[model samples]
Target: MITIQDIRNAQENIQDTINATPILQSGQLSQLCRNQVFFKCEHLQKTGSFKIRGATNKVKQVVMEGAKLVTAASSGNHGQAVSFIAQQLGVPATIVVPTDVNPCKMNAIDAYDGNIVKCGTTSAERIPRAIEIAAEQNGLFIPPYDDPYIMAGQGTTGLEILEQVQDVDAVIVPIGGGGLISGILTAIKETNPNIKVYGVEPETANDTFLSFQNGRITSITPTSTIADGLRATQPGDMTFPVMQKYLDDLVLVTDEEIRRAFSVVMERMKQIIEPSSAVTVAALMNKKLPLEGKKVVTVISGGNVDLARISELMIGTERIY
Candidate 1:
């Protein structure tokens, strides 16, 4: 289990490499939600996502211990993050991605000079193939999630949230493999147990919510959603336990709701966030929880959406105020 100290050390390890993204008050969203809402703008972080923090910490730790190469699997953000960090550290990186990965992320990985391998479009296929490649090349495997270092590194966001909003009443985070939420929940609940933590997922990919409700890890048939980053079929083994123990609630949103939220942020918050990031905002706008009049923080986890697809997502959806 990753402890708070591990998270602190991770913060120190990657402090110079990663930016401490700002937590800005979203007056428009606050008024709409009838609460004081703050946005943790992780979308502004390097590589346009918070994945860089964990990727950098993991790569740096291994490189310092004589690692020459590393490999990882990502749908998009994690691949870009690992490749970018590895390039900075002068370590060779190979990234295995799903066959249908977003082109923007693929281009970013190429820009960072990370070797790309396309495999079947599922974590089951991508993870095994990545590990096989790492073994064949005598390189380290940096998991997208399910590792202590990755979780601890991601926990730094929670530390920032607590520092930035001292009296935060609640935090809403999007759930994928549960890495980000696991880290955040650990940091927030350990530091101040009274602060409520909620995890949100697209209705099409609600594995984490199912796991939370079942009292054990559960998986669903692979499904697709606009929030590609949150499409993991199941919660990670390491991350599930932490979420089960710390999350105050788990909520689900539809692709329609995510689209509306995406439009809302772009128009009102003046931020172009990815669909996964919009999940948090969707939760708030849809009133998934009883947060009226409370001080809420929503983590906008990334901004790496393919610009070519934004128009299609917003074409028919009516943006709710």
Candidate 2:
């Protein structure tokens, strides 16, 4: 289990590399939800996502451990994050991504000067290949989630939330592999047990919710959603238990709802956000939680929406449903 102390240490380790992103009040969203809403603008962080917090901390620790290279598997955010950090530290990185992962994501990895290995079509397949490559080449494996160090690093986001919103009634986070929620829950509940944490996921990609009910990890049959960043097949071993212990609820949103949230963010908040980031907005817009009139904080996870995809989500005639 990761502790608050570990999170504090990570905050210090990666402070210079990562941004203390702004937390902005979303008046439009608040008016719509009839609640006080503050958006943690992590989408504006380095590499355009909060994943860098964990990836940088993980790679920095590995380099101190005398690892010559680092390996990782990601859908998009984590791959870009690890690659960027590895290059910054002058350490080599190899990223194994699912074959069907987005081309824009691949381009981002390519831009970071990281080695890319095309692997299986799911995170389940990609992770094993990362491990294999690490073993074959004597490199360290930087898991997207499931590692104590990674979890602790991600928890620093929660610490920031608490510091910014000491009287927060609820914190909403989007869930994929559960790292973000796990870290936030650990940090928030430790400081204020009264703060409620909600995990939001697409209805088509609700692996963590199912895992919470099953009392074990569960994999979803492969399905596609607009929120590709939240498309993990299952909950991670380390993240599952933390969520089960700390999360107040797991809510599901539809693809349409997610797109609407994307539009709301762009139009109302004047902020560019990706689908995965919009999951937090989607939950509030759909009233998935009982958060009327309460002070709520929503973690805007990323802002890496492909321009073409954004056009399609907002105005294109193609069916996203």
Candidate 3:
């Protein structure tokens, strides 16, 4: 079980390593949602995500234990994060990514000088390959989530939110593999028990939401969605239990809703955020969560959208309206 102590230890380990991303008030989103909306801009972090916090901590831990090579699987952000951190620490890194993973993320891994092993097209298939590589090469497997260190690294985001916002009523976070929310929930629940922590998922990819409801890990066949980051098929065993204990509720938003929120972040806040990162904002704007007049913080998880996709979404939204 991941205790708050794990997050505290991670905080100590990664204090000087990762950026303490800003928590800024979004006037436009506040007006639209009828709530005081604060955006925890993890998109601005090193490697363009909060993943760096966990990746840094996990890599350091692995390195300290004399692991020369580290292996993991990701579509992009986690891979970039791990690869980049491992390079900084002078450790060999291999990222097992889906052969069809997004070009932007693959470029990010390459930019960090990570060895890319093209695997099958889904995380479910990619995970075994990572494990296999880890076994063959005697490397440590730093999963995107499902590890205590990673969850603690993600919990650092919640720590920043609590320190930045006073008397926050709720925190809305996007859920994929569940590491981010698990960390946030653990931190928030321990620090301020009264604040509600909600997990948001794209309707096209609601594995965590379904898993929470079903009382076990449930798989979903990921459909076409703009939020590529939220396309994980199932939640990890470790993260699901943490979420079950700490999260207040789970909400779902459509792909269109996610795209609109992505556009709004670009236009109003002048910040670039990926569709997966926009799910929390999308939920708030669509009246899916009852947050009127309350102080709510939404974690914008990443900003790594492909330029072509953003153009298509912008033009498509204009045509529809």
Clashes of 1: 0
Q: Candidate 1, residues 1-321: lDDT per residue as tens digits?
A: 788888999999999999999987768789988899999999999999999988988899899999899999999899999999999989999999999999999999999999999998778779999999999999999999899999999999999998998799999999999889999999999999999999999999988888877888898987889999988989999999998788899999999889998988887777889999999988999998988999999999999989899887773424475
Question: Considering every candidate listed, which one attains the maximal lDDT?
Answer: 1
Per-residue lDDT tens digits of candidate 3, residues 172-209? 99999999999999999998899999999888788988
The local lDDT score (0 to 100) that residue 52 gets in candidate 1 is: 93
Q: In order, what is each prediction's RMSD in angstroms?
A: 1.1, 2.3, 1.5
Pull out the clashing pairs in model 1.
Answer: none
Q: Give the local distance difference test score of model 2.
A: 0.88
Off by over 4 Å in 3: 315-321
In candidate 2, position 243 carries an lDDT of 91
Q: Model 2 over residues 1-321: C-alpha lDDT tens digits? A: 788888999999999999988899867679987899999999999998999999988999999989899999998889999999999999999999988777787889999998999887778888999999999999989999888888888889999998887689999999989888888998999888899999999999999988878878999987789888888999988899899889899999999888888887777778988899888888988889988999999999998777767777763223221
- Models 1 onward score TM values of 0.98, 0.96, 0.96
